[model samples]
Structures are given as structure tokens and as C-alpha cells.
Target chain A: MSLLRVENISKSFKTLQVLRDVSLEVNPGERHVIIGPNGAGKTTLFHCITNILPIDSGAVYLDGKEISKLPAHHLAHLGMSRTFQKNNLFGDLTVEENIHLALAAKKPYRYDIFSPLISRTDIRKETNDILEQWEISNRRHVKVKHLSYGEQRLLEVLLAMASNPKILLLDEPTSGMSPAETAQTSEMIQKLPRSVALVVVEHDMDVVFAIADRITVLHHGEVILSGSPDEVRNNEVVKEIYFGGGAKKHA
Target chain B: MKKLLLGVVLLIALVFAMPLVLSDFGINLATEIYIMAIFAMSLGLIMGYAGMVSLGHAGFFGIGAYTVAVIGQHVANTYLLLLLSVVISGLIALVTGAVFIRTSKFYFLMITLAFGQLLYVLFWQLKPWTGGADGMSVSAILNFGFGEIVSPNGFYYVMGIAFIIFYILLRLFVESPAGKITKGIMENEARMSALGYNVRVYKLLAYTLSGALAGLAGALYAYFNVFVSPDLSGWMFSGQVMVMVIIGGVGTLLGPALGASVFIYLQNFMSTYTERWPMVMGALLVALVLAGKGGLIHWLQHGKSLFVARKRTGEAVSQQPVKKGEAVH
Candidate 1:
């Protein structure tokens, strides 16, 4: 059975139709990527799937259960986790604190008056593991606002991972990064547990080609193509519309 | 950990010994300070941590005070009346917070202010129950089941304990995941909503919690002072709470208390020499603003040495960090 399934999802903002009859599916442990030219509504699709925006028409299901109408917070409680195109980690909190909070969201703990946060050994261990994986252990006490830009982006994704989600929704996970940082993020994405199904929206064609098991192409709020990376790269229609006739570069 | 323990011990000692330091005039001043600190703390909960700017905490404060005064005037058992007053004020807060949290920042501030002013007018116009402009007085001080609570010193101890308990409670809330979500909402509501939490419900809960605490302080004031008036609901009173919160460093748990203590002392010390006490307060506020740089709390938390280090490092970097709501895409 598909871990995540979208059925004829459509959405509009004000008078503008943003997504038109979009449908997709990710089977368990599959890595899926959605790509399109600018204004392709990749972000919109992520929003719909994550329940950030109400659909004009359609349904989203997780594990065959309808969740098209669930609120974002409830969806999170239902084990859906997502990262934004932009870094959205808590600025004032330390790196450990941010990860700890994400962990706390997953499980209830003794957060009472007079009790210390340091006493929660399980949370501390979990936070330490995430911090170690993200290579931010040395800067655990550093606030997000004080971190380097690339580090902040990594921290954002790390925070999303700390929630121990079943399915991850990442919107442009490598946005605004240097070439080195982009490569690092790609490696990190590859390093994530394969058991966690992923639905990623990305602009970098190389990154999409490098990791995505399958690609879904959207243009002007409609799916233009859906296939394997080689199939999409060789498609004459995709070349004509998005790739400038395929002369410049190839992933 | 040792330092924190020492600090708590010192605070406890100060609270216990405060009553001995007070003369008759000093006792009244100290009582007002305790009440104002609690009022400021409630405002801190919403404004500091939750990022809601409330300019009408005085309305909740007045509601609490009046509830006690009216009930105390009629009921023979003062303790029961105090308890009832706090409960009633909390109910009002629950209803008001439910409505107020639905709106955005500017709208929230304006609506709360309007509600406060409306309460003020009602307190003035309702001559029979509220005693109109003259105000109303309680028949006697409260008597809890354990013993009679009458002496100014005795009441000081009660206020002191309550402040400590609430301070600890508020600190816990700030550190909780729920509290972190509130902080997140303050940063970006759109992001928070997208993350799946009901932004409105969390904000409303925080506002209600804050209002209940403010009302608790007000109830204490009514019984201690033996009177309640429309002045409690006035815009000026709201402004005072805002000033105290700002001076103390908005989100810091201990900051509001320290700010209130300093403000009360300043008011008491300055009024002895001048009829223009308001003007002195204004000048003092201006001086504080000038010295604040970032904010009083920022200065206090970072300290002068750290500020210098931060400035040096910040200049070396020279790029402005990304602000809230700026998406990478």
C-alpha cells in the first residue's frame, strides 16, 4: 500500500488557480521528488499534502486513511513532519533546545514547575544523537540566530528529523546554499533512514536526479510528466519546455 | 546551580524580612508594589513569551479587585469573597481571551484597550454597586480556614508566597513545548499554522492564564487596601503595567518583578520632594530608554562585557541576519 497518496488535488488562491487535479503517490520507503519550472505549484502541492492550505478539491491519504481536512497541528500529531523552503528554527533557543522541543512534541514528558530539563535522560540522549548527526554538537549551546547560514539550514532539517516522523515533506531543502553546502545537504538526505518515506520539492535538477527514485514534473499548476529520471531527461516535451532544448547541462 | 540556589535563598529572606522594613506609609507602598508586580507578571506572560501586546491588563485587574470589593461588602466571610472574586475574574478572562486571540496584533491591542475603557466607564456609571467615582470598600479583611489574615505584615507574606508560586509556574510554562510553540507563533504565525498547531487556541490559553494571574493579584489588592475603584481599569494603569514589563525586560521571568520593585521605589522616593511626580517618572523613563540601547532585558541578560564582545563579532561579520518571515525560496 502507498504510504502517501494524493487523489485529484486542486487548490486556488483568491482568483488564481494554483494546483489543478494533481495526483501522486509514494509507496512505503520510496524516495519521491516533485519538480517543475517556476510557478509549477510544487510548493503548493507540499502545502496541500501537509494540510497547510485547504484544497479547492481533492483528498490526501496517509496509509489509506483520509487526512485531506486535518489541521496542520493535528497532522503533525498524526506523525507527519515537514521542512520549509526557508529556515524556520527557533532563533532564541539553543540548538539542543530546538531539537529537544521537537522531540517533546512527539512524546509527553514531565515539564512541570521546579523540575529541571536536564533531568530528562531520554530526551537528552535523543537530542544529542540528532545534534551529533547534524555535526552541530560543538555548537549545541549556540542560538539559531547566531549560526552560519548553511548551519542554520542544516539545523532546520535536523529539527524536522528530530520529530522521528514516518513521512517527511521537504520543500527546497537545499535552497540558498553554496555548492559545498548543497553537496553536504544531498549527502545528509542520502544518509537519512530509508524506512522514512520522503516527498521532496527541489529546484536543483542535479540534486533531484541524484537521489529521487521517481520524478513528477508540474508546469502551470498541472502535472506535465511523471516517470524515472532517465525518462524525464530524455523526454522531448520536458526538454522543449524546461531545459532550453537540453544543450546546456545534464545531471 | 549553586548560584541559583543562593539567589533563591536570598529572595526568600528578602520576602520574609520586607514587612519589618516598612513604616505605616511604607507598608501601603509595599502593598501596592506587590500588587503591581503580579499585574506586570501577567502582562509578561502574554507580551513577553507569547508575543501578544496587551494594553488592557488593567481591565482584568479591575475586574478582580471589584469582584472582591463587591462580594466582601455583602458577605460576612471575607475569604470566601476573595476566592469568588478570583474565580469570576478568571471566567471573564477565559471569555475575553477566546474572543481576543482570534484577531491579529494591532486589532488585538486595540480591542483589549477598548474593552478596558468600556469596563472603566461601567465602573464609573454603575453608581449603586461600584459606588461610582467614589469606589467601594470591604467590610473586613479576609480570614482563611487556618487563621485570620488581617495584619499588613501577614498579607505581605501571603502576597510574597503567591508571587513565588506563580513565578515558578510561569517559568515552567515558558520552558514547555507548548510554551515554545507560543514563542514560535510570535515569530511566525503562518509557519506555526503550517506546522499544524492551532495558533489561536494556544494564544487564547496563554491570554487566559495571564488574565487569571492578573485577577489573582487584583483580588489580593482589594482585600489588602480595603477598597476598589474605576482607576484599576483605567488606561493609565495599563500603561503602568506595560512600563513595568518593558523596564524589567519583557520575557524574563524575574525581570517584571524587579522592574515593579524599582518603579514602586522610585515613585515613593520622588513623590516626597515633588508635586510633579508624573513628570519625574517621565524623565526617568526617558533616561532608561536612552541607556537601554537594545532593551533593558537584553542589557541585563548579556551584560556590558558580553555586549562589547557581541558588537565586535557582529561588526566583523557585517551581514544582517535573515529576519522572520523571509522565505529562502
Candidate 2:
């Protein structure tokens, strides 16, 4: 059974229709990529599925259960986590502190006021372990605003992953980075355990082809095609709409 | 940790010994200062940690004061009055915060201001209960079925103990998981909400806690002043506490207390020699702004670091100082 199923979702802002009858599905452990031109409603579709922006009409289901009207936070509680297109880090907090907050949100004692955060041995151990796993432990004590841009992006992904979601949605995780940084981030995403399914929206073709198990092309608020990378790379409509005319070979 | 402990111990010693050197009037003034510090610190919790700037905080303060004044006239039970005041203020905050937290920035400020003014008018027009514009005198706090604490020194002791207890509790809270979430919300509410936190619920809790603390201060204020008036809920009073929080230091744990003491003492000292003390106060505030954007606590920290650096180098420190909110990249 599919883990996530979006059935005919539509969204609009006044006369502008951002998403029009978009439908898709992802199985457990599949790395699905959504690619499109600027203003192709890729982000809007992601927002509709996550319920950040209420849909004009349609239904979203997780594990065959309807969850179209649930709030974004409720979706997160149901094992759906996402990263923002823009870096959405708590700038004033340290790296470890950021991971601790994400972990705390999942814990039963998130609202516990009397217990000092430093005294939570379990939370501290988990935070340290995650930081070490991400190889950012040396900068654990530094405020996030002090970290380099690549490191900040890494932290952003790590924060989303800290919740240990069954389904992860990453929106343009490498929007602004050098080619080296982009390759490193793609490698990290590819290394994620198969227990966590991924849905990514990316403009970087190299990263997309490197990490995607399947590709969905969107054009003018509609799905142009959905298939494996080789099929998507060979489709005539996708080639004309996305790659202009001729397909540029990628290494 | 040792230095902090010593500072706390010295502070306690000085508070305990205040009556030995000060006159009766001075002792009463000190008691007022302690109460105001609690008020300021409560506002700090919402504004500093939760990042919700409210302009109607004095409404909660006034509600607490009036609860004591009206109830104590017949009951004279200090403990019951305090409990009622805190609970009632918290309820009022919960109701208002539900509406106010949905709005951002300017809208929040206006709504809170409007709520405060509404309460002020209610207190002014409700002649039977509030004594109308003339205000009402309050009875002394009954000493826990023992006796009345009528002495100024005795009252000062009570106020000092309350201050210490509240300060410690607030400090611990700011270090707790809930407090960390409050800071996270302050930094980015959207991010917190997206991370599966019910942001509004956390904000409402912070608002309610702040109101309860303010109510605690207000209940004490009524007993200390022996009067309750509609002015307690006015916008000016709300502005005064906001200023106290800012002038002391917005996010620091003890900044609000220091701010309250400095503001009250400056007003007292300036009024002694000059009839135009308001102008003098305005000038001092402007000077503080020009000297540095960071308030007194930040200034003290910067100065101490600079002094240490100079002593160690035996030369003039020439590096550009790191500004607040700017990470050392």
C-alpha cells in the first residue's frame, strides 16, 4: 500500500490557480522528486499535501486514512516532517539546542515546566548522538547564525530528520549552495536509512537525478509526467517543457 | 556558580538589613520597589521570552489589586485574596490572549491597549464596587491568622521574601523545557508550529503565567499602598512596566528587577530637586538610548569584559566590539 496518496488536490489564490487537480502517490521507502519550472506549483502542491495552505478541493490520505483537513503540526505528529525552502532555523540558539527542541516536540515531557532542560539525560544523549552522526558536533555549542551557510542548510535537514518521521518532505534543500556543497548534501540525503521515505522538490537536475527513485514533472499547475529517471529523461513532453529542446547529458 | 551564589547571598543580607539603616518612609519605598520588580519581571516573561509585546499588562495588575481590595473589605484573608487574584488574573489573560495571539505586531499592541482601557473604564464607572473615581482604601494583610503586619519593616520583609521566591522560580522556568520552547517561539513562531508544536497553546500558557505573576505583585501593591484605583489599569501604567522591562534589559533574567529599581529610584531622586522631573527623566532615557541600544545589564557585561581585556593586555583595546544579535562569524 502507498504511504502517501494525494487525490485530485486543487488550490488557488484569488484568480490565480496555483495547483490544479494534482494527484500523486509514494510507497514506503521511495525517494520521489518533483521538478518543474518557476511558478509551476511544485511548492504549492507540497503545501497542500502538508496542509500549510488549505486546499480549495481534494483529499490527502496517509496509510489509507483520510488526513486532508489536518493542520500542519498535526500532520507532523502523524509522522510527516518537512523542511522549508528558506532556512528556518532558530538563529539565536546553538546547534545542539535546535536539535533538542525538535526532539522535545516528539517527547511526552515537551510541556513539562518544572524539569530543567539540562537535566533531561535522555534528550541530551539523543541530541549529542544526532549531532555526532551529522558530523557537526564540533560546532554543537556555536549559535546557528554563526555557522557557515552550508552548515546551516545541513542543520536545517538534520532538524527535520531529528523527529524521525516515517515520511520526510524536503523543499529545495540545496537552493543556494556551491556545486561542492550541493553534491555533499545530495550524498547525505541518499545515505538516509530506507525506513524513512523522502519527497523532494529540487531545481538542481544533477542532485535530482542522483537521489530520485522516481521523477514527477509539473508544468503550468499540472503533472506533465511521472516515471523513473531514464523514462523522465526520455519523455518528449518533459524534454520540451523542462530541458528546452535537446536533452543535455548529465554525468 | 560560586560568584552567583555570593551575589544572591549578599542581596539577601542587604534586604534583611534595610530597616536597620533606612527610615520608615524609606522602608515603605523599598517595599514598593520589590513589588514593582515582580510586576516588571512578569511582563518580561511575555515580552522577553515569548516575544509577545503586550500593552495591557496593567489590566491584569489592576484586576489582582481590585480582587484583593473588594474581597478583603469583608474577608481580610491575605492567602485567599492572593490565590483569588492570581487565578482571576490568569483567567482574564487566557481569554484575552486567545484573541490577541492570533494577531501580529501592531495589531497585538492595539488590542492589548484596548483591553486595558476597557478594564480601566470598567473600574472607573463601577462606583458601587470600585468606589468610582475616588478610589478605595485597602485593609492590611492579615498575618496568617496570627495578627496584622502593620509595621513598615514587617511589610518590607514580606515583600522581600516574595521577591526572592518569585525571582528563583522565574529563573528556573526560563531554563526549563517550556521556557526553551517559549524562546524558540520568540525566534520563529512559524518554524515551531511546523515542527509539530501547538504554538498558540504554548503562547497562551506563557501569557497566563505572566498574568498570574503580575496579579501576585498587584495584590501585594494594594496592601502596601492601602489604596486601589482605576489608574492601576490605565495605559500609562502599562507603558511604565514595558519601559521598565526594556530599560532593565529585555531578555536577561534579572534585567527587569534592575530596571524597576532604577526607574523608581531615579524618579524618587530626580523629583527631590526639580519640579520638571519628567523632562529630566526624558533626557536620561534619550541619553541611555544614544549611549547604547542594549540596556543596563548588557552595558555592564560589555564594560566588565572591556575592563578585563584592558587589564590583561596593559594597552588600549582596539578591536570592534561584537554587537547584540550578531553572531561571531
Candidate 3:
């Protein structure tokens, strides 16, 4: 069975039908990349899968069990994690503090109010390990807002990874990064261990071909194609949509 | 750690030293400041950390005071009364905050203000139990096993001790993991939810904790003034505490306490000079808040930097002069 299954899910906001019967699946350890034009409802699909936006129709399942109605926060404890299209970091906190909060959220002691988190040696060690693992330990004390845009985006991914999730959803992870930063992020994505499945929404074609084990193409709020990387790259419909050959406007 | 210890030591020393230097009236005012400080600090918690700006905090404060006044008539135990004050207010906060946290920003402020007014009206109308608009005197003496604390000096010391204990408790809470999560929720609620946090729960937690503290402040005030009034629960009082939190600096625990001190001192001292004291107080608070970078705490930081700059200039006089408009560490 697929590790994450997004069954015939459709979402709408008022009159605007953002997603229409979107469906996909990810196997354990699979690198699934989602590519689409700007208005293809990629992020909306991410929201629906994570239960951030309640779907207008259909359902989502994790490990064959339906989770379409579960609260968004419950998705993390259920072995799923995600990043936003935009950097969603704790801007005022230090980088280490942000990591600490992410790690703490998954722990039973997140509700521990009497004891200071700094006194938790276990949490500190884990935070340090994750920070060092990402080579961000050197900038640990700097507040996230002070970090470069690349660093903030990197921290967003680091935080998502802190949960040791079974399936991680990254939404345009390199959206605002410089080219060098994008390459670095791609390298980081590649380096991510296979214990976790990756579902990435990326626009960079170079990064897309380099990392996508399987590719899913979305257009006009529907998946036009889902196949092997080579299959998706050679598809005429994708070529028309992406390479300016299509009669369809940039919707 | 050493700095923390020194700060505590200094606090303890000041608490002991202030009574000796102040007149009887000054001591009384200081004690009132302590009580207001607790209430203001509670508001500061939700405002600064949880990103909740409430305009109905005094409702909890009134609840605390009235709890003591109404319950003390039946229960003589002071400790039990204070505990009841905290629990009752906390539970009320839990229930009310459940509804309040659903609203954000200006709506939140308005909802809280409405809650405060509702309680204020309740107190005003509950004549037999609360003595209505005339208010009721607290007959229950605060007997802590050793002796009854009835004098101004005794109340001053007791309030000071209570304030310190609360300060430490709030400090520990802010440093706790839950507190960190609450701050994160404040910064980015959707992100927090995406990161596996029940954002509403944390917001409610902060609100409940804040309400309990405000209630305790009200209870303490009931004992200090020996009076319970509907004004305690009014929006005006809530608005006053919010101003205290804002002018003191919203984020730091000490900032609100300092803000309370300045506020209470100015109000008390100014009232004696003129009947237009509220106007003066309002003007002062507006000036302090408008000082820019954020409340009085930031101004304190600015002041410290200026002093350091002057000292550095003096030290560097014989050496190479510092570059103009150069960034200091």
C-alpha cells in the first residue's frame, strides 16, 4: 500500500475551484516531485493533504487509513510534515530556538510548563545534533530574521526535518533563494535519507530532473500527467504548457 | 546564572529597603503598585508572548477580589481564599478564552472588553452578595498562622514577597517549552499548526494563566484596600492594565512591573496635585509609548546605550577617534 494516498480530493474557495479531483500516492522512501505552473493549485493540494484546508469533496489517507478530517496539527504526529511555499519560521527566535521548538512539539514534554526547556539536556542535545547535521550550528544564535533569505529557507526545511517524519512535504522549498542557494537546497534534499518519503513542489527544471524519482504534472487545477521522470520530461502536453507552445494562457 | 542571582539579590534588597525609606503613605502606594504589577504582568504575558491584546483583563481582577470578599464571609482561611481565587479565575479563563481565542487582533480586544463589561454589570447588579455599587469591605483578615497582617508595613512586605514569587513563576513559565510554543504561535499561528501544534490550545493556555494571575492580583487588592467594587471588573481597569503593559514594554516580565510602578506612582502623586490627574497620566503614557522603538523598556535600553557611548567617547579621546555613523557591535 502507498504510504501517503491523496484520494479523489477536491477543494474550492467560494466560486474559485482551486483543486478538481486531485489524486496521488507516495510509496515509502520514494522521492515524489510535484511540478506545475503558478496557478496549478500545487500549494492548495498540499494544504488539502495535510488537512490545512478542509476539502470540499473526497478524502485523504495515510497508510491506508483515512485522515482527511483530522486536524492539521495531528498530521505531524501521524508521521507527516510539511513546509510552506513561503518561509514559515519563527522570525524573532534564534535558529537553535526554532529547532528546539520544532523538536519539542513532537515530544510528550512540550506541555511541560514548570521546567525550563534549556534544562532539558535531551532536547538540547537533539537540537544541537540537528543543527550540526545541517551545518547550521555556526549560525545557531542568530535570530531567524537576521539570517540571509537562503539561510531562513534552509532553516524552514531543517525545522520540517526535525520531526523525523515518515513523509515530508516541501512546498517550493527554494522559492526565494539565489541560484547557488537553490543548488545547495537541492543538494540538501538529495542528501535526505530514504527513511522519509519526500513530496516536493519545485519549479527549477534542473533540480526537478536531478531529484524527482517520479514526477506529477498539474495544470488548470488537475494533474495532466503522472509518470517516470523521463516520461514526464518528454510529454508533448507538458512541453506545450512549459515551453510556450500551448494555446492555454498561463493559468 | 550569576547575573540572574545578582538580579534576584538586588530585588530582594530593594524590597526590604524601600519600606524603610518611604513614608507610611508611600509604603501603601508601593504595596498597591505590587498588586497592580501582578495584574499588569499577567496582561503582559498574553500581549507580549501570545500576541493576544486583551481589553478585558480587569474582569478577572474583579473576579479575584469579589471571590475573596464574597467567599471570605464563609471561609476564614486566607490561603484557601487565594487558592480559590486563582483556580476560579483560571477556570473562568479556560471557558471564556475558549471563545475569545477564536477571535484575533481588534476582534479579540473587543470580545475581551465585552466580557469585562458583562462581569462589571454582573457585579453591579448582584447587590446582596456583592453590596452592588456601594462595594463591600473585606472582613476576612489575612491570617498566615503566625499573625494577622493588618498594618500597611505588614501588607507591604507580604505583597512584595508575593510579587517576587509571581515574577519568578512567570519567568520560569516564559522559559518553558510550552511558553516557547506559545510565542511561536504568536509569531506564526498557521506555521505553528503546520508544525504540529494546536495553536488554539497554546493561546488558551496563555489566556488562562494570565487570567489566574490577574485574579490573584485582585484578591490581593481586596485584602489591601478592604474593599470589593464593580470598578475592579470594568473595562476601564482592563484598559489601564493594557496601557501599563504597553508602556512598560510588552514582552519582558520586568517591563510591565516597572510600568505599573511608574503608572501607580504618577497617578497617586499627581492626583494630590490636580483633579486633572487622569489627563496627565494619559499624556505621560502616550508620550512614553510614542517614544518609538516600543515601550519604556526600549527607552531604558536606549538610555543605557547613550551612557555607554559617552563613556566610550571619553575613553577613546587620547586614542583614534571613532568613525562617524559607524556600526557598534
Candidates in order have lDDT scores of 0.79, 0.87, 0.90
TM-scores of chain A, one for each prediction: 0.93, 0.96, 0.97
Tens-digit lDDT string for candidate 2 (A1-251): 99999989888999998888899999999999999889999988888888888899989999898888876778778888898898999998898889989999988888887767867999989987997898877787799898988899999888888888889999998999999999999999999999999999999999999999999988778887889999999987776776564354221
- Give, for candidate 1 chain B, the lowest lDDT window spanning 10 residues: B320-329
Q: Itemize residue pairs with steric clashes in candidate 2.
A: none
Residue lDDT tens for model 2, B151-197: 88778998998998888788778878889998998898778877899
Candidate with more favorable, higher TM-score: 1 or 2: 2
Error of model 2, residue A49, in angstroms: 1.7
Candidates' chain B TM-scores in the order shown: 0.86, 0.90, 0.92
RMSD of each: 6.1, 4.3, 3.6
lDDT of 1 by residue, B1-329 (tens): 34346656776787778777768677767767877888888898898878889888899889888887776666757667656766777788889888888887899899999988989999999999999999988665667766887877777777777777777677667766667667777876765664556788778878878888888888888878888889999999898888888777777767787778878888789888987887987877788878874346566667865886687667758766533322210
Q: For residue A70, give model 2's deviation from the true position in Å.
A: 1.1
- Candidate 3, which CAPRI tier? medium
Worst 10 residues of 2 chain B by lDDT: B320-329
Error of 2 at B30 (Å): 1.8
- In Å, residue B59's CA in model 1 sits off its true spot by 1.5
Give candidate 3 misplaced runs (Cα > 4 Å).
A248-251, B305-329
